[model samples]
Target: VLKGVVYISLSDNMLYKSGSYEMSDQAGETLNKIAKIIKDYSNYDVLIEGNTDNVPITSKNIRNNWDLSALRASSVVQTLQNKYGVDPKRLTAGGRGEYNPIADNSTEAGKIKNRRTQIIITPKLDQFMDLIGKAPEKS
Candidate 1:
């Protein structure tokens, strides 16, 4: 296909242990699948976005859900780069916390659904050969 992209939704139940950013074994496997997609679609960019429930983190340093989400996203980005040889430059790590919840936060199930880490793979705009002539030069 011409436009290659992979968007995978990792539910909160499939994530790392509570209060940690390390992915579970199954989550690691999912990350592996993501890595393979990156390797398969050469010249691609990966966006690792972390999301969290409306609940706040009472941990010592994790003052808010934002910290938790951001850290999780960073952790995933590190995993892809360190374990899978994915170029660091091609990866973007970010977090939406409870701001971009995909589900309601009023119930346990909804909160669980609200928490997630989305791995989005897409062709890098600047690296696309086909877009070479379509894009305006920087200078």
Candidate 2:
């Protein structure tokens, strides 16, 4: 059983076209599954983080890896909020550019693996206050 929350990593190829932030048609099914899971757990907040390979991006729209990664993350966030109706307050988007890689960037396969997104589901801390125990009131 999950102790607190679930974490899912989605490859960029599964969500967006190469070098573009536009969500692909296949992304719909994936997002749908995520939405159902999020709906079941109202006490958790979702963090969507986008990552990129170390290769330099020189596209007209995507100036650098930072912009590419950030826009990708924001695109996913928008889809979740607008298409799936997830609570805006419970979602956050982050971009890691090419700085945090789970695989070596020397190989094509590894680079492919590095270009991905991570969805982190964490339980809200409000319910943990009792477990943490409150401080004594100031006298």
Candidate 3:
């Protein structure tokens, strides 16, 4: 956790097949664990961010990495809401494409490291605002 927010990073291979946005068969068990966390933190909002390596890709359905990343994030959000009963209002999905790489994308190992999904859980904005309002004002 950072600054009162919880971040959970899941490797792409754990969630999807190579170059595919469809969740892998084994993704359910992992997602179930995350869903449980979301349910436990009722006051927090969830952000699902999908990221990819620098490699270019083109498929009949996916035009590029951006499309793939977005579709992947949306898929996770849908599953969390539809299957896990997480509140739709508390979830947000974003795609970083190949821009936000946590590791070098030059080698195969680096590329593998770059492909990931990050689940961020943070307290609601209202709670943050309330804390800020209670702080001492600058002179």
TM-score of 1: 0.83
- Model 1 pairs whose backbones collide: none
TM-score of each prediction: 0.83, 0.88, 0.92
State the C-alpha lDDT per candidate.
Answer: 0.82, 0.89, 0.92
Clashes of 1: 0
Candidate 1: lDDT over CA atoms? 0.82
lDDT of candidate 1 over 35-105, digit per residue (tens): 88788877788888999999878888777888888899998899889988988998999988899987789
Candidate closer to the true structure by TM-score (higher is better), 2 or 3: 3
In TM-score terms, candidate 2 sits at: 0.88
Score residue 122 of candidate 3 by CA lDDT: 90
lDDT of 3 at 67: 88
1 or 3, greater by TM-score? 3
Compute the lDDT of residue 80 as modeled in candidate 2. Answer: 94
As a whole number from 0 to 100, the lDDT of residue 62 in candidate 3 is 84
Residue-wise lDDT of candidate 2 within 1-139, one digit each (tens)? 1456688989998999878889998999999999888888888888899999999987897889999999999999999999999998999999999999999999999999999999888878785464346545568
Q: In model 2, what lDDT does residue 16 have? A: 96
